[model samples]
Target chain A: MMHINDIDTPSVLIDLDRVEANLKRAQDYADMHDLPLRPHVKTHKLPEMAQKQVALGAIGITCQKIGEATAMADGGLTDIFLPYNIIGTSKLDRLVDLHARVTLSVTADSTDTVAGYAARFGAAKPLNVLVECDTGAGRCGVQSPEETVELAQQINDAPGLTFGGLMTYPPRGNIAQADAWLHKAKAALESAGLPPKVISSGGTPDMYRAAEGTATTEYRPGTYIYSDRMQVAFGVGTLDDCALTVKATVVSRPNVNRAVIDSGSKALAADAVPAPYTGYGHLVEYPNAVIIALSEEHAVVDLSACVDKPLIGDTVRVIPNHACVVTNLFDMVYLVRGDTVEREAKITSRGNMR
Target chain B: MMHINDIDTPSVLIDLDRVEANLKRAQDYADMHDLPLRPHVKTHKLPEMAQKQVALGAIGITCQKIGEATAMADGGLTDIFLPYNIIGTSKLDRLVDLHARVTLSVTADSTDTVAGYAARFGAAKPLNVLVECDTGAGRCGVQSPEETVELAQQINDAPGLTFGGLMTYPPRGNIAQADAWLHKAKAALESAGLPPKVISSGGTPDMYRAAEGTATTEYRPGTYIYSDRMQVAFGVGTLDDCALTVKATVVSRPNVNRAVIDSGSKALAADAVPAPYTGYGHLVEYPNAVIIALSEEHAVVDLSACVDKPLIGDTVRVIPNHACVVTNLFDMVYLVRGDTVEREAKITSRGNMR
Candidate 1:
C-alpha cells in the first residue's frame, strides 16, 4: 500500500469507499423498484468492480460491445447482456462463442442484424435478442414502437434467435418521452404475442427518474459508479460522489494567473461537452480554478479565483467531463482509499472498440 | 496478410505506402533546409515507426513525457528530447534513472524547474538542459529573450546541469515572431559566452513556415506522419496524406439521413476543437457527411447530402479530429499497403501518461 502523496503524478485514483457506497445505493434503488440491476461494466471495466457489484446483489452485468462482454465473461461474470447492435459475420461468430461460455444476450434494431445473429447461433444455441428502440436520443435503435414489435417478431421467428426484451437509451431530459415509447413498445409486443421479458432502460443522467411500470424490468446505469463533471453538470451527483480523479502535477507556472499541468487532452481526454458551467474540467479539491484549455500534453488551468494559488510543484486531481472516456484513456487505475493505494487494477476491457 | 475488407472493424489501419511517402517528404524538406528533423513519437508511439523515421534520416526522437521517452529508450532509441518542464521530485528521480539508461535531455522555462533537475541529476550526471522560450504560444516557457539568457545562465551555474540549447513551440501564424525572439536569445547567450549548440523550434502547424536565421538547428513535427482532421482544417495536409484512419461499422441507420457507427468518442476521441465543423470526427471515404454527434459507443453521422448512403452492415473509415489523441485511444494498429495488412504493430508506448 502506498500513500496518495507517494503515488506518481498523472495517475488515476479511485476512492473505493465511495465506489462501494455508490454500488450499494444503486442496488438499493433497483431493489426498491423491483427491477433487476444490470450495471454496465463499461464504466469501471475492472473485474473486481464487477464482482463487487454482483456481490452487492446486481442480477447481472451490461456491456455495449462484444469485446466488453467477453472481457466480463472471462472475469467470471456468468451473465452478461450486450446492449448494442452486433453486426457483421465476424462479430456474430464471436457472439456465438461468448454465448457458449456464459449466458449472453444482445440487442438489435434491424432485421438484417437479427438474421445474422440467427444464422450464426440459431443452430447451436438460441441467441437472446432485445429490440433496441430510439426513444429520443437519435443515435441508434429502431424509431417507432411498431418497428420494435416487428423486430421482436422477426427475432422470435428466426431459427436461432429468441426475443428477450426491449432496450433504449433516451436523451437526458426526455424521460417522459422514453416512458411513453417503452409503454407503447411493450403494448405492441404483447399484442403480437411476443412481450419482452427484460425491459431495460437507464442512463446516468436520468437514473433517478427511471420510470416504473411493466415496460422497465431492469435498469442499466454505467456512470453512477464514478460520476464525472458531466454528471455533476446534469445534477445527477455531487462532487463527493465522484469516485475517480486524474492526479496531475503543475509543471510550469508560466505567469501569475496561469499554470501548465502534465495531464492534458491525452490524459484527461478532450471531451468538452457544452456544460451549464465553464472550463474544460472541474478541479476536485479546488473548484474555483477551471481547466481553461488543453493542448496535446498540457492543460492550461486558470487559478485566478482560488485563495491559495497552486505552485509549480503542487499536485491536483481533476475529474474529467466524462468518466467512461477517461477510463479508456488509461491502461490501469489505482484503487485507493484516503492515502493508501489498495490495489492496481488493470482496465482489462479498455480499447475494446470492436 | 489481411486485406482491408477482411480486417476487423474499428481497427486502426495505417497505409504504409502513404506513411513512407510522408516520411520521405518531411526528410526532403529538412534536407533542403539543412535542419535536423527530430520527429515527435507522440503521434505513433510505435517502435517500428520510430525505426522507419530513423531509417528515413531523422536525427532523434522527441516525446512530451518521461514515460514515452523511457518506452522509446527501451525500444533501443538512445537519444530522446522531452520538450516539457520536469518539476516533481519523484518524476525528477525517475528522470535521473532514465538519464543513466539513455541520453536524456529536457526543456525548462523557470528557475525552480531547473533547480529540481539540478538537485536530482547534478551529482551523478550533468543534466542536458534546454531553455524553453515562449514564442507567442502562451502555454509554457519563459516570456522574453533576455529571460531565456538568464535561465540559460542559471542552468549553467547549477551544479549538475549543462545549458545545451534553446527551444520553443510557437503558435501557427507566429513563426516570424518566434524567429526574431530566438535570434535575439541566441545573441544574448553568445554575448554571455554561452552559445547554444542546438536550437530547436517545433510545432507541426508552423513547421513548413519556419523562418530563416532563427538559429534553429532542429525541427520537431509530430503530426506530419499521420495528418488528421485538425491538420487538414489548418491547411497542413490533404486527405491523401493521412496515413491513419479508424475502420468502423455502420451499426444503425436510425433515420433516412442518419447513420450511427460503432466508433464514437472512446474510439475516435472527442477532441472537437475548432468548432463549426460539427462532428467528433470526419468520415474518411465519405467526406460530405459529417459525424454530427457522439455518445459513449455511437458516432452519429449526418448523411443528408450523401448521394449513396451506407447500409447497416457497411464499413466506413474515419479520420479523427486530432491524430495524437486518437493514437492514445487504441492499443494496436494494422500496417497496410494498398488495402492489404502487412503487419500488426502493438502500440506499446501508449498510456505512458506518467
Candidate 2:
C-alpha cells in the first residue's frame, strides 16, 4: 500500500499493466507472423518477467550470458537459448551443468568454440549448438554463408553435439538485409546436406516486421518488452508504451534554465540515444527539457525551452535511452499499476556479465 | 585460491600494491599541504578499500548517497560527509537516523533542504551543515558568496543545524577560481559573525595543488586511489598509477585488424575518455589497439596500429576511462598483490542511490 511519493527517489518504476500490454503485443505479433518468439532475458534480467513472457506464449527464452541462462533455468524456465559464444573451460562446465537442467541451446562463431563445447559435453547429453551468422550487425559471427555452413558441418560431425540452427543479431530496423543473408546461409546449409533446425533473427526495432516468408523461423526481441526512447525513435512504440522509468527528484536548480536530477549515468545509464533524439533520457512531464550531461550521480538538465521548469525537490520520471542498461543499474524495480506499487521485483540476473 | 586464468572473463582486478601506493600518495600530499583528507568512497564502493584508506591517514570518508555513508558507518568508519543536496521527507528521516549513528555532515544549496534538515533533527544532536558553493563546476550549489552566506545564516539560525563550513567541487584543474570563490564565501560568512569550522574543496586532478594558502581546510579526492585513463589524460597520474583493470578475453577475431573482448559497456562502462584521448580504455598490453565501440556484451577493438594482434582466447587487461563508474558495474572485485589473490571484496555500497 505504498504511494508513489512514499518510495525513495532515484528508483526504477515498472508499470505492470504496460508490461502486460507490451508482452501481449509481442506475443500477438509473433502469432500473426507464425514466428516462435524467444524473448531475450538480458533486457529485463528478472525471472518473474521471463515467466510472464513464457506464460504469454513465448516458446523459450534467449540469454547472452551463462549466468543469465542459469538463473532463468533455476527459476523453472525449461527451454533457454544462449545466442553467444561460450568459450573457455570454466564457461563450458557451466554450460554442461545448465544443459542437464534445461532444454538448452547455444551459439558459436568459430570452430575453436565449437570444439571446446564438443569436448566438454562428450560424456553428457547431446548439446544443441547453433552457428552464429554475421548479417549486417558487424559483430561476432561467421563472415559468409559458406563459413556458416562449414561451422554447421563441424557441429553436426562433433560428438555429443546437435547442429541446432543458425542465428544472427541483425542491425536494428534492418531485417531485410538479415533475411537475405539468413536465406543464403540456410540455402548453403541445405546444399551441404545439413539444414538448420531453427533460423533465428533478432532485434527489437524490426521485431513486428519479421515476416513468415522470411528465413527467420524465430524472433528474439529484448528491448520490446520495455520500449525505451530508442525504440520510440525507431517508430516501434510511443512514450506511453514505455513500461520502465527512473523516478528522480530535482536536487538542485542551479538557475532558471538549468536543473539537476538525482539520477545520473549510474541510474539513467550512459547509453546515448539514436540520432534525431538527444540527451540521456526523455522527461515525461518536462518534454522540452534536455538532459545534456551526466556525471556519476547527477543528471544536468537544460530547461531553456521548457514552458514550465521543475523546481528543486520535485520528482520526475525519466525514460532512459536504453531500458536494458538501466535495469542492470538497479538491484530491485517497483512493479506498479498506475501510482500504486504492486511489488518489488529483483533484477535476478543483474551483473551476470561473465 | 583462484588463479588468474581460472577466474571468469570480464572481471574487475585491483592491484593491492598500486592501491597502497595510491593511498600513500594522497595521504602524503594531504599531509604536506597541512589539510585533512576525506576520500570519497563512491569510486570503490567497498568497505575494505575505505578501511584501508582510513588506516592510511584519512580523517574520514565522503559519499554521495546516504546509503553509501550508512554502509561506511556500518563498516566502522566514524565521520562521513554527503556533498549532495538531499531533499524530501523520506530522505530527511534517513539522514536523521544516519546522524544518530555517526558524525555526519551534509551539503545544501537551497534553504528548503536546510529547513527539512532543521525540522527532522530539531530534538537530536545538532546536524553539521555545509553550504555548497558552486565554484565554476556549474552543477549544484549557490550562485554567489552572498547566497552562500544566506544559506549559512539559515543553517546557523535553525534549531538543530550547525553551520559547519563551505565546500565546492571545483572544475577539474581550475583550483584558482575555486579558491577565489571559496575565499569570498568564507569572508562573507566571517563578516556575518559566523566563522566556518571547515572549508573543503575536492577534485583529484588538482588535489596536489590544494596548498595552505587556499581557503580549503579539507580535501576529498575520490579517484586518486584508482587512477584511470581520464586521470592520466589530466596529467594527475600515469598508466602505471592505475590500480584497477578489467580482465577480458578476446572472444572473437572478426578480422586481422579487429578483435572483440568479453568486456563491453557493462564491464568497462560507457564513460568515454576525456578529450585528446580515444577509445574506451587503455590496453596495457596492446598500447596501439583502440577500443572503438562497446555494445552491451562486446568491446570492439581496432588493432590496425598494433604490432601484434590478440587472437581468440587471449586475455588483456583494460584500464577503464573512468574507474569510479566501472566500480559500480561489478558486484565483486578481486584484490590482488602481484599475481596472487588477496581476497574478493564485495561492492557493499553499490546501487545505493537511494
DockQ of 2: 0.76
What is every candidate's C-alpha DockQ against the true complex, given to 2 decimals? 0.83, 0.76
What TM-score does chain B alone reach in each candidate, compared with the true chain B?
0.96, 0.98
What does candidate 1's lDDT look like per residue over B1-354, in tens digits? 668999888888888898898888888888888888999999999877898898888988998888888888889887889999987767787888898988878999898998888777665578899999887888898988888888999889988999989988877777777888888989998999999989998877767765363578899989989988787777777878888899999998978999999998888888874644667777876888988888878899999988889999999988888889888988999999997889898888788887
Q: Write the per-residue lDDT of candidate 2 for residues B1-354, one digit (tens) a residue.
A: 776666778899999899999999889988877888999988899888899998988898999998988888889888999999989887888888898898889999998888888888874589999989889988888999999889999999998899999988898777888888888888898999998899988878888787833798999999989999999999887999999999999988866788889988878888877888998998899999999999898998999899988878889999999999888988989998888787898888788887
- The global C-alpha lDDT for each of the candidates, from Candidate 1 onward, is 0.85, 0.88
TM-score of 1: 0.97
lDDT of 1 at A158: 85
Candidate 1, residue B337: CA error in Å?
A: 0.7
All candidates: TM-score: 0.97, 0.98
Please state the error at residue B240 of candidate 1 in Å: 1.1
Interface RMSD in angstroms for candidate 2: 1.0
Residue pairs in candidate 1 whose N, alpha carbon or C atoms collide under 3 angstroms: A122-A160, B122-B160
Candidate 2 residue B117 C-alpha distance from true site, Å: 0.7
What candidate 2 gets wrong by more than 4 Å, as runs, is: none
